[model samples]
Target: MDWDDLRIFLAVARTESLSGAGRRLAMDASTVGRRIARLEAAVGAALFLKTPQGYALTAEGARLVAPSEAAELAATAASEAVRAEAGITGQLRIGAPDGCANYLLPQVARDLCDAHPGLEVQIVALPRVVNLTRREADMAIAVSPPDTGRLMVQRLVDYQLHLAGHRDYLARHPPLRDLADLKGHRMISYIPDMIFDRELDYLSATGMEVAQISSNSVAVQMQAVRAGAGLGIVHDFAIPFAPGLQRILTDRIALRRSFWLIRHADDRASRRLSLLADALAQGIRAEVLRLEGLLGPCPVRGT
Candidate 1:
């Protein structure tokens, strides 16, 4: 029943590893283990089952998750209420796609930091989905909205992707007049097997079987195309920044993808989250407008 113990338990449950929880909490692994033991003893139940993979929650621990989350929310709300009087101060972690994280989020982070000098922001730019339930990130910019989870999901913006190639590469290769011409050109894209999200399967929409040059990172893929490696699907927002890149088949080949902003349902009540979400949405909207100006509005397609 101690709030501190419940906090420790929640961290361990979310991470499923003592060392992970310890690192997040700034405590050593032994200290985190002892805290978990104390929490289990106080509750008079074995909260976790230790396994080679990590800790698996016991039935009792699973049952406690909801209430623990509620407690955490209430505590956060209380803390935020007090902090509001003095101005917001806390860390906000965002999980974003590589393109957005590298090209977009930095400006957003700067604006957020300038507005609230005490706030800290971290952006994790990875291709994989971030598990909000595990607190991998406070919020995330994802390609698709999650179908199941206690999450607050919203469609942030729709952006375009186009088949792009460097000027030198296009001049060296045969003209790409139609879809069939794609067969003759080298392609750069995400590795088919390494694509973590189905939304990232860009080449498939082009009727291409595979890419000759592949990478898991969109940034890398873009670089490959920029270096005249081959034609690759690049975000419209990113194209303006890369010199000598041209959108190929502008009218024939364009893919529209959406960015969804997601956050843990429990965190919705926190003022910091509310403010951060608003800032993220605004930044994305501005970027989308810029992208639209560069590439024209995304053509509506049937679902």
Candidate 2:
């Protein structure tokens, strides 16, 4: 079967419709349908089932997914190998949690673009983990490393978090002398059930089970904390961006977690991905250090 047919097949399987695949491939729906039929004929089996809603992958289609994806990866690697000479220029979409995207990605993008004038970078910030297998992003930066899938994981950098509060909020409330005092302060964080990663449940170890103010987005949480909505477990790198925020019980509550660089295993051979990943890792490490350095000394250990 033609590799182009397999490419179309993967697009349809991902989007679940001829029209959807057409939009992705820049082909008409009828043309996409004909290609899918041609692929089915070459393979001697129907690959999709027509349902009221859309095309659903049949058992045969399901089985073909892995090998077809491998073919797609190979094709992509071949094309990228040639383009590598053009100096890392292409659309590289990176999916990341909103906090990093909001607070960290702009500078990374600036550095990459300034270095490689032709490259276009897209930062897709979402509330949940990025789905690289589905081609949602060429790569992703994640707080928690994934356990499943043909993916490569690398530790990007470790960052610190601490219980923090707006100085106005701290002044309005009773003094926060220690960890035990957190029980009375309004705390902001990810909603308990909506937290997408265990590492992000930053308030859990503090014996606080509920968040009085919460949001799925870290930017929102930080904004709420800055607006004096509540005290929160916040990234030290981020605290400098939100003025008037102070790290509370810093010595007692300092926390460390890491960001990971994740990508499809098949992409290891692609120079574009490799270059982009290297740049991202270095940029993030430098940015994190630069931002955290902007923070003033943390609040005294107690009182």
Report the number of the highest-lDDT candidate.
2
- Cα RMSD, model 1: 3.3
By TM-score, the best candidate is 1
Error of 2 at 272 (Å): 1.5
TM-scores, in order shown?
A: 0.93, 0.90
Score each candidate by Cα lDDT. 0.87, 0.89
Model 1 segments more than 4 A misplaced = 291-303
lDDT of 1 at 117: 93
Cand. 1 Cα-lDDT: 0.87
Error of 1 at 246 (Å): 0.9
Candidate 1 lDDT, 138-247, residue by residue in tens: 99999999999999999998888888899999899988777888898999999888898898999986778989999999999999999999989899888877889888
The lowest-lDDT stretch of 10 consecutive residues in candidate 1 is 294-303
